[model samples]
Target: QISEATDAPEAFVAKILQPLSKKGILISNKGKQGGFTVDLDKIEHIKIIEIILATDGEEIFTRCAFGLEKCSSEKPCPFHFTYKPIREGLKSSLSEISIYDMALKTEQGEAFLKI
Candidate 1:
């Protein structure tokens, strides 16, 4: 449903599922009733960071401002200092959250904007 609503491609969907499937965070069924569904018990164990990295690639959160090949503390980009905190915060949040938490919040109408 989410994929259909967002019009994401199958490859993108597969990418998002790959790591989770490997980690048993999501279970894929095969049959007439087969489809993807969350494993609530394991969902909280999988960090959102994994999903983000799998689907969008880590560069979305950890890319240099100047597109340098190996930007870091020693070889900082012009905007590295300014970008560092925001990037860290984003990484921190993603690593901390889980699919289970998100679903509960959504069910309770406590977080996120409606589409």
Candidate 2:
């Protein structure tokens, strides 16, 4: 839908779609009435973290706070130590959740609706 609507390159669209499909995060249909739709039931089982990591990568939050190479605990960058906790927290939160939790919360009106 995104690709068709946006007129994006097929390769680019495929790149974006493949990972989601492999993770069962997206379902695509074929034929005259074929299209794409989110499997809400399965989606409920996914975590925000998995989606983030799937699309972005686990290192996204921890990649050298200042974009420096070889930043680490022993030879940390000036900002590394300070950024560590924040990065870890973000990563941990993402890795510890599922989409189901989000759906249930949303259904119960316990989750915030984003525009």
TM-score list, all predictions: 0.72, 0.66
- Alpha carbon deviation, residue 25, candidate 1 (Å): 2.2
Query: Of the candidates shown, which would achieve the greatest lDDT relative to the real structure?
Result: 1
lDDT string for model 1 (23-106, tens) is: 566778779976578766677777888777766778978788778878888989888899989988999998998877787788
Q: Mind giving the per-residue lDDT tens digits that candidate 2 earns over 1-115? A: 5575457876797677767777778787778986556786576566787777677776788689898889999899999888999988877786667767765776687974442
Off by over 4 Å in 1: 4-15
TM-score of 1: 0.72
Compared with the true structure, all predictions reach lDDT values of 0.77, 0.75
Quote the positional error of residue 49 for candidate 2 in Å: 1.8
Please give the lDDT score at residue 111 for candidate 2: 79
Cα TM-score of candidate 2: 0.66
Worst 10-residue stretch by lDDT in candidate 1?
1-10
